[model samples]
Target chain A: MSEMLWGIVFLLIALLVGFFITSPLLIIISPLVEWSALMPYTNRSKMTWLIFFLSVLYLLIFIGLVSLFQSNFNGMFSKELALIFLSIIVVEFIAVRTTQKSLYQLYEQNKWPQE
Target chain B: MNKDLVKIILVTAGAVLFNLVFWNEKLAINTVLFDAFLLCALFFLYPNARKSAAVNWLLLGHLVSLSMVVIHNTDLSKIAFVITLLLVAGFAEYIHRSAWFASGSMLMNVVMIVASFAESFKINKSKPANRKGIGRFIRFAIFPLILVIIFFLIYRGANNAFSDIANRIGAQLEIFFSHFFDFFSWQRLVFLLLGLLITGSILLKSKLDYFSTRETRMNDGLQRSRKPMRQKRNGAFFSFVEMIMGKMASGMMALKNENTTGIISLVLLNVLLLIVNGIDVDFLWLHFQYKPGLPVYIMVHEGTELLIVSIVLAMAILLFFFKGNLNFYKRNKWLKYGAYAWILQNAMLVSSVFLRDYYYILKHGLAYKRIGVLFFLLMVLIGLVTVFLKIWSRKTNYFLFRVNAWAGIVVLVLATTIHWDEFIAGYNLKRRNTVELDVPFLLSLSDKALPLLDTNIVALQKRENDTRVINVNDGQPACDTCFIEQLKQREKQFEQRQKEYTWLSWNYADAYTKQYFRKRGLITSIH
Candidate 1:
């Protein structure tokens, strides 16, 4: 029971970190993600629950990946790999920033629907 | 804007806070993965050409290709990554504008999009009810915090059992409280305020009152003017506005004048450029061995700087010459041709610079600066082409700006994808003439240098040994022994490249090098 409790604590901690870093980016892109995920499903309730389930899945996958990284090299770092990782983040940031700005402008100028 | 978006925002914000509080670290794959997932989510968020959110097959394919390059992360795959990214940018431009071969206005679109994030927030004065609610929240939180502290103090003073219970909860609470409280530190507080501002702006993203509001204001103005213009409220302010407007009008009139001073200046400048280009081709290219003994450093460095500045000045001049009356400046054919000739000469100069750089690369092996110079020259060439296109098509400045922006983005993304250290190391090592090879520079590269260097280890080892066997009979160290010292310096570079095997920082290239070195018994197996 204690072990299970600690596991839950660890899981919660991991989820929190993953969410904060991912939130601004997700919030920027939320309208599109909302549209894409909501399009195929007709019921709002069902879609919301489905989206919630997906977030959980995303959280679990993130934890697993972090675990794999931890177990791989025992904690030393490679400059090249760090560079590769940083590049991905930089590219991603620019992409999302640009796209969201476009979406915001469209919605504001054209009254493109808040829903 | 929907409740679902609110929920997603809430959850994502919670995650960011969690990372900051619990999992913040300098080197983290978790951070990388979270970022990747968010980026993948961006594909769905992207607005289509028709101002709709739609996910097509091609978009998905592009996303998958990039994700693969990011995840699989090998040398060859990075090449594919760069090409695909450029293609993605071009495709996005095409779809957004509904035009192939996008012009320069697209660059403005990019700037507007990047700038739009500032519009994502808003701040409104807090109403009494909202303040009351905030007060209530603080009261609830502080009261509980006080009770917990007081109860804990009592429990410790009361008995062993109670004290044990309080201590356990206190231990856990300390972790939570410290992490939470850390958010109030000066730096973190500043970030939190910034985030609040951004989030508020996003939450308050104005439904662009731009067009509709303007229309209403215009109608109101017409209605007000129908009643007869009101007496000027402030004559001085009106006079100031009028004076500014007059200056702008006069500036335009001056620009349109036939005796525009710049025309004579341009004539002299064009003649000077012709003379310079004449000298460049005649000597710098045809009979150029400008500095044979010196390293190709000066040519690649100084020459690239000179050529770029020349092209930029040429652009500023071209833009100036084409402005106002000169657009159709009655019978300035010689001037137009002169400008074209100057631009054409700039293009040739870029090529000549490239040739010199290539010659340097061939002789001295590749360096980061050389590679960067190559990319810069590519931009210069692109700028020159845009200038030519601008003149030929009589396109707007927006077209020039847009194409150049796209060219720059493509070049940058392409350049980033290359594994330069490995490429340079391999290229230099492959050069047949060892005498021409920059052995010392090659030795200084990362583990990526090893696979190629492995072949020449025997020669390097011999030279390393010969450095110590210097002859003192001539009382001079500057003989065959100097070459041995050069080789020794190359060997000494190995000391800097110690293999580190931590999952948090492991690079495949480094691991490969470590294993290879271990097999050769040059380094210990940390694994």
Candidate 2:
């Protein structure tokens, strides 16, 4: 497949996974992770395993949130929802930066395209 | 799990902990706990943050400010709380590139963090496929929905059969969704989104170059500009004079002109302030009198504000003169001496303001504004000292700001540690014989002062009987019985409220107040 096609496909897969689990972090991170695949330096097999690992991690977060909502929320009528959303944002930012940094490192190790 | 993943999970867990601590409660011990959790999360997530002296100091300041909320929690403490949070966010972002920042960078860091968050959320137009697709879908969806609604209305009007079917379907849909509507809270969803935005602003490091670039360019040294006089500049608005004087002598001439202007201005200002300060010393310091029937405003009203303006203007004028090449001029010694004299006079002016507030508090008893005046005067004194330092050390204006800003923060944090309400109550009570105690004013104090008021009930009653003591709330004579009843009612309400507080909402002030009431038999022990 062409790199452009691969990019779109990865993006679709990311959106699909994010939609399924309702994790904004994965929605943001997955496509970028896939984009890393196009880099000459990225090990394809390692990227695959990373994606799988991330999916499991996203699933755990999904489950944790759902259970917390069930136990702590009775239809989400108050400020606790706000606090939960705040935490989600903090998590999303950390995840994005970490993923981006790791990808840059991978590319740099293999003679980054920009250089 | 990797450290990043652990950080993510820990942050989320901290949010849950935050929710549990603050759900349906006021800020108190819960804020302290959440702050500690956040600091720990930051430390673990950003190991480099530990190396930054500014970050470490801010962390300590944050802990102290949060603890003040549990101890006293006045408006000053709350303001300190918010300032500390901004400082934390600023320093956290700054440590991404370097571990050090100027003291003035506190404000800039806060501003940049906000700007960076805005930058991060900015949608990339280059990534057109995703945005365009989403935009097209929303546009198509909205257009069709509107057309459908309009046509449905037209059809309903034209055909009774269709109208009946549509109405029946709508009713059934509403009935089915009423249960869902009952459970769904739009407020909660909106608050959740708001929380997300705020949290992202603090935690996310922005890619903005505005603040960092400016910070990198900033230097504390007062460097002499080597720009040739031939190049026209804004400061050379008097270039025609330079032309007439000749370029070789122009730089020296301009420096002499600035130096002469500064020296003359400072000298005149100092002499004028000397007269003012001398008068203040004589009236407010040496021979102060408590004149009965004199309004309190005469002593501390517009006068204090006007003097404060002058004091600030004094610093501004000195900064204007000493701002540039004047500091490096060979003949600038006399000018510097004059500047020093003006600063000394301003310090004396600040002392006079302090004395004025002292006399006002002595006359009218302590209030928020009176206490605020003291703090404001303290800041002015510090400002003057910093300005003096700036001139003496040949430092940049940035140095003045950096030193003064930190001084302001230190004063604010220190002020928050005191229980002002109790302090006011105690101070006013001690001077009941010398000053007219404002009974209604004391009654309006926070729960922290209740113990003090209760302890002095007999003395308060005696003052209430004196015709000189008036209920400022009304034109009527003060009644001790009415005052005592009001006090008892407040005690009851305080006890009931204290009982409702969980461990999360616990604070030393409330706890001690409750304990005091319980021991006095005003509140029964809960089994």
Candidate 3:
């Protein structure tokens, strides 16, 4: 049981370090959020919705892990935890791609106004 | 402007905070504040003047200057003297720029002489006059002092953490003099020093208007000498070479503009060159491997010969085939593919020396210390590859080249994986043979542990054991005989395991090291 707990802790630490390393990418991308606002209402709202969905996805992963800990079924919980973590990674990747595409679309649609 | 100031402050604060977090470094907050105050004073003093860029450039330049000062292993007084000479030279340049030509030039020359002397003696000194103006003094001193304090604090913290990390990590860094001294070979050292001198001279000359004026004079002369007879005689050859060179130059410029493709090509070229250099040596061959009177590998070896031959052949081939094919490569898809291959081949050959040295380092521990030579060779290889690619590809667009470069990486990675087991096995075997061992236990132990031994200990033990036959008083048995006997036994066991599992020898050795270290209490726990 202790070994399992330690493993969980190690996984969490690794996740945290990974997040820290990836933070620079997020910082670089954060400026695009302002540019996203200039898009047509539908496109803007779509991106907002996507971001909201991503947030929800992250929350769900956290909730699933917490629930797993609360329920004392180790084998099932471990398997589910792994699946949840993998899903989180997939979702993050998808979110980044979507954000990038939305940014490109916005740029394409909004050419500079002629003098 | 206030926003810009705030941004700068925020960036500075963030930088400080990052250092504090990662390195537990303390910022000399008072010193920084003082510097900021002084900078504000300077801004106020030069309110109407267009000096912002100058100030910013000076500050940026000082970062390099101060770093050179701090990192250089010289006495404080000597450092101060050198700094004084540099300041004098900089002031002289400032004077020259302000149009005091002859006097400024003389002063600058004087400063240079003084600076050179200081350099020869390796002496640099800080200026007492810099402390005269309260704001100017603080502006100069405070920032550097803060940087120093922060650096020291970070260094202390990092050292402690690094020591702890090293202790936790089973592999410890040991410096072997043989590897270390090999880097300082006279030829390489002389070349490096010469290169530095040449670069310094070039920079100094560029700063003078002498070259510009001479170039202008040459251009004027060329324009004046454009007679019809001369034009008729030289027109064909001149036009041909000019067209080729012009296209090449423009292509390079275009490639530079297309950053992604150009960079990828450059990187690919470098990687290819590295691979070629790495394979230059007949690593598997016996005569080259076991040569007496200083390993041929240390000095110039078969690898060098192969490298020269490959480069010459590549150049000849490229010149012959692609002499007038630039336009074709640019327009035709098939030709472009061929061009890409040529680029890859060139890059591989150029980067081979670096890759080979890197492989040696990875094979041998940090104890094999010819890092200087390795770095020098790598630098030279990179420089040559860059120049070659620039000339050949004409600075091709990064976007156009990036995909191909990435494909090359994928292929290389695949090749690496294919050879991964052999490399690991070889490395482990070398490592194991190097270390001291209890001959009986070593002979009995699994073949997997043999490669992990330090060569120094093994060699020493080998010597001791060899002498023991003549003097029975020596307790230890012959290491080479025992090692061979043990290896034979382990080889049979390994062969059996190999039949059961593909590449079991490599995997077993890796696992054995982990287990050995774990048992030795080097590792706290395995992940």
| Steric clashes per prediction | 25, 0, 50
How many clashing pairs does model 2 include? 0
Off by over 4 Å in 2: A1-115, B1-15, B95-147, B158-161, B175-181, B227-252, B468-480, B495-501, B522-527
- For candidate 3 chain B, which ten residues in a row score worst on lDDT? B217-226
Ranking by DockQ: 1, 2, 3
Interface RMSD of 1: 17.6
Per-candidate TM-score against the hidden true structure: 0.52, 0.72, 0.26
Per-residue C-alpha lDDT of model 2 across residues B355-464, encoded as one tens digit per residue:
77777777778898888888888888888888888888888876777677778777878888899999999998888788768777898899999998888765676656
Q: Candidate 1 lDDT, tens digit per residue, B216-276?
A: 3221011112111133324574345346545432344533343344456567777786787
Better of 2 and 3 by DockQ: 2
Q: Model 3: residues >4 Å from true position, as ranges?
A: A1-115, B1-208, B212-300, B308-339, B350-355, B358-369, B384-527
| TM-score, predicted candidate 3 vs. hidden true structure | 0.26
Clashing pairs in 2: none
Worst 10 residues of 1 chain B by lDDT: B219-228
In model 1, the runs with Cα more than 4 Å from the true position are A1-115, B1-36, B43-263, B290-293, B432-440, B461-527
